[model samples]
Target: MSITIDPVATAGLVSREVRDGSRDGTPTKIAVARRTYDAEQSDLWQAVTSPERIPRWFMPVSGDLSVGGRYQLEGNAGGLVERCDAPESFAVTWEFGGGVSWVEVSLTPADGGTTLELLHESPVDPDFWTQYGPGAVGVGWDLGLLGLGLHLATGATMDPKESEAWALSPEGVEFARHASAGWADAAIADGDDADAARAAGERTLAFYTTPAPTPEA
Candidate 1:
């Protein structure tokens, strides 16, 4: 099934920020994305933190979920919970492969719903940042936010197979383009060269929308 996504609406719903800092003397960059969901802070918190609910929108999670405890995402990253403040915010160590990063999620109440903010901080690897820009991580979170929105609105689990198909569909391509551009803008706002940021954005767009390479004959 083809999913019709509104690129403009999606773009409007998310706000991105890139912040530069240092971690243990290594340069680091934090990519932050915020969006409002049409649900109460409590409900949104449960949707994100509950292991049972996570697989519905994101991926299956296992392990201790409390503060100072470790958690793992099946076939994905695992981490230690650094902080947790119930229906409000949490921070974790996002360990993947041999690299480690940090992720924090915050929730704030709004007029009709809750504002969710995700912050991912990692040591800045020049090569990767130069090639993919913030969309490397930003776009992934953008898609997660999309899934969260759907779950909050419909209370139905999305078919993973269908969601994969949708990502390569025309609408998905457009959405990626918009999201990539948004990340580029955020990078530029964070003092990146505009030309380089736009170029990286194009690469990121291609990465997200392009089909995998076929085997050589």
Candidate 2:
């Protein structure tokens, strides 16, 4: 499907933040992203929580999907649902690559629509943070938010293959670069060195915008 969007404008719609905290006695870094969608609270809530609808914007997910139940996103993280409050908020453990993180999502009425806040908190990895900062996870969520917005506006289920292609397109590259810069600013606001954060953002921009190597014929 062809999509028309203002890459920088859409990237600006999200409010980003980086936070430092502790979880289970381990230092943690939090990436927070907020955006208001042009949908009613109930509709936005359904778009996010309903299994039948998730794949439309995100990815295929399976397994039990309730408090204490386990769920997995296709080719991505799987974890246990820790809490749920219908049409309002949910918290889940994000288990990936043998590391555990926490994700919380909350919805609120705002600007005649709904505002969604996504917070991803994970134990700090010095090596990873030095290389990518918050943009590592933040850019991915930014793309997810973009997909959800597009799905909400058009009521069309996104084609995963097409979505991947778009991410490599010029427009998508612009969006990724803009979003990476936003995350870098957020990191700097949270006490990261300005130059290092900017450098990390550059790396992140390249990471998301780089096309995969072609297979040898």
lDDT of all predictions, in order shown?
A: 0.91, 0.95
Worst ten in a row by lDDT for model 2: 1-10
Candidate 1 weakest ten by summed lDDT = 1-10
Residue 133 Cα positional deviation in candidate 2, in Å, after optimal superposition: 0.3
Q: Could you say which candidate leads in TM-score? A: 2
- The lDDT of model 1 is 0.91
* Clashing residue pairs for model 1: none
- Candidate 2's C-alpha runs over 4 A off are none
- Candidate 2, 86-133: lDDT as tens digits: 989999999999999999999999987999999999999999999999
Q: What is the per-residue lDDT of model 1 for residues 1-217, given as tens digits with 9 covering 90 to 100?
A: 2345586687669999999988899999999999999999999999999989999999889999998899999888999999999989999999998999999999999999999999999999999999999999899888889888888888988778788778888777888888999999999999999999999999999998888888999
lDDT winner: 2
Q: Write down the TM-score of every candidate.
A: 0.95, 0.98
